[model samples]
Target: MTDRTATAPDIVTGAGTDDACCLFQRALGERFKDLPRSVRDLHTVKGESGWQGRARVTRGKSRIGALICRLVGFPEEAEDIPVSVTIERRGDMELWRRDFGGKMFASVLCLRNGEERGHITERFGAMAFDIDLQLADDRLQFPVARGRILGVSLPRALLPVSEAGEFEMDGRFHFDVQVSLPGIGMLVRYQGHLNPVRSDD
Candidate 1:
């Protein structure tokens, strides 16, 4: 219900010069211009911005899946839940905070260097996933190609899997993100639409 992004005036600094501030554009290069207006705008993090929307938060029914979701502060199963997202830039890292109803979780995103070149790395708690941003049919897809726990790279077959993407429909930015473990099935799936919060709202 609260728009923390609008109030975080100190989140952006003029000196912060990280491509992650505008992650998609950096990765897609000139092709970024071909994306839908909504998708492009939502991924462009300038300072701290807020987006509001609705989502269906579904936790996997599996025992381990539910436990993992709960441990990561995921929202309980719900439909038409209010969603709020805030993206803040701190140096080369982008802190993305999402609120599903009253429950909130955050992740840090940046461009990968080390071993995985030209990939976007997202860190949620102790798990870090390297995602390759690929555009297909006006959608930006996030494919988790590699994963690490506590900075230690995991084996190839043991890496967690993710099916995520962003697009636009009916003039609103929509996203579907689902992550799953090797044998644990789905971890969580949240699909919804978001619009930039305007001053009038």
Candidate 2:
């Protein structure tokens, strides 16, 4: 997404004092404990040296989607590494494209090493759409066969990481998500944790 209005926080933040990674793990456990009914189960598998897992998403109490995520292609001592995620959904096949791949509605942030690396943002006209994003300082512009873009800003907060390695932060992060469906004039907000993954462990 073109971050024309995106503003960096006045002060960037890290994790809690004990151990940033530990804090992250605790927070994720607490958050997932209350996942919506649409989500059946979420778990992380620790391999000999990395992480991988499958998240199951449900629809009307039936398992209908699965997302496989992994921290592959990272060095052993790499405190900050990249992750890859692939989501697959079943039902109303056409909607899946617009929901996950089309321009009008899609995730705006793709991260590498816990930093915003790229995204898919689009502007749509009824059915046709245009898209753009910034990856490693390079901007890739293109269009899609369907769906439209809704421009919005993402709200963020700072977590203070002290020299002693202890940290804590309090605030809600929000994102302005705009999308145009065939019959829906869309404007909405997506609210979630600023950083979902916590530790390299």
Candidate 3:
């Protein structure tokens, strides 16, 4: 599927020309403008062939953190794995659907930014958490922010950090993501290249 039309201007901007929400939203888009335009579009992009790639996930060194990864349903292995990712823009939020080694995972990301607030839903609201972002020069960092389990906030001290960097290499779009904790070392890191495949969705 292709969303050829542009999404409407953000409603939050109607409050005022210099409202905090409007400022942050514009800043967020400007920071990552080097990426695919669809990344900033609040509309779905899909294809029958989709995007194909490879990923490697390295578990954290801390034993407790590794255990927590298992408990939280993270794959514990550190090896090269084939994967596919499908991203769709739904309203103001984006849905990233990934299939790795036959196990599917999905996350919902809300792009509105204003002082880092609220629990963004994921997996169709089976999970939700607030996220803190550090966006700069085509790179985005998800510094550990407060999270919620069943709407109960988790301690800030226990959250982990994750960051992503995107660029073009060998004429293909490339991205790298790393997850780490203060005392737990690195949780997982994945890097891959993707090229668009044209097809009717």
Q: What is the alpha-carbon RMSD of candidate 2 to the true structure? A: 19.2
List, residue by residue over 70-185, the lDDT tens digit for candidate 3. 54455546477777777654434455666665656556556434323322323223335555556466444455455666667667666566575655555666667776666677
Cα error, residue 91 of model 2, in Å, equals 28
- CA lDDT of each prediction against the hidden true structure: 0.78, 0.21, 0.51
Model 2 earns a TM-score of 0.20
Q: Identify the superior model by TM-score, candidate 1 or candidate 2.
A: 1
Off by over 4 Å in 2: 1-130, 134-174
Model 1 clashing residue pairs (backbone) = none
After superposition, which runs of candidate 1 have C-alpha atoms over 4 Å from their true positions? 1-21, 114-118
- How many pairs collide in each candidate, listed in order? 0, 9, 0
Model 1 root-mean-square deviation: 4.4
Error of 3 at 77 (Å): 2.5
**Candidate 2 lDDT over residue span 63-101, tens digit each:** 111110111111111222232222221110011111111
Worst 10 contiguous positions by lDDT, candidate 3:
1-10
Candidate 1 local lDDT, 13-72, one digit each (tens): 336465453766666778788899999898787677899999998888899888878777
Better of 2 and 3 by TM-score: 3
TM-score, every prediction: 0.86, 0.20, 0.64
Least well predicted 10-residue stretch by lDDT in candidate 2: 65-74
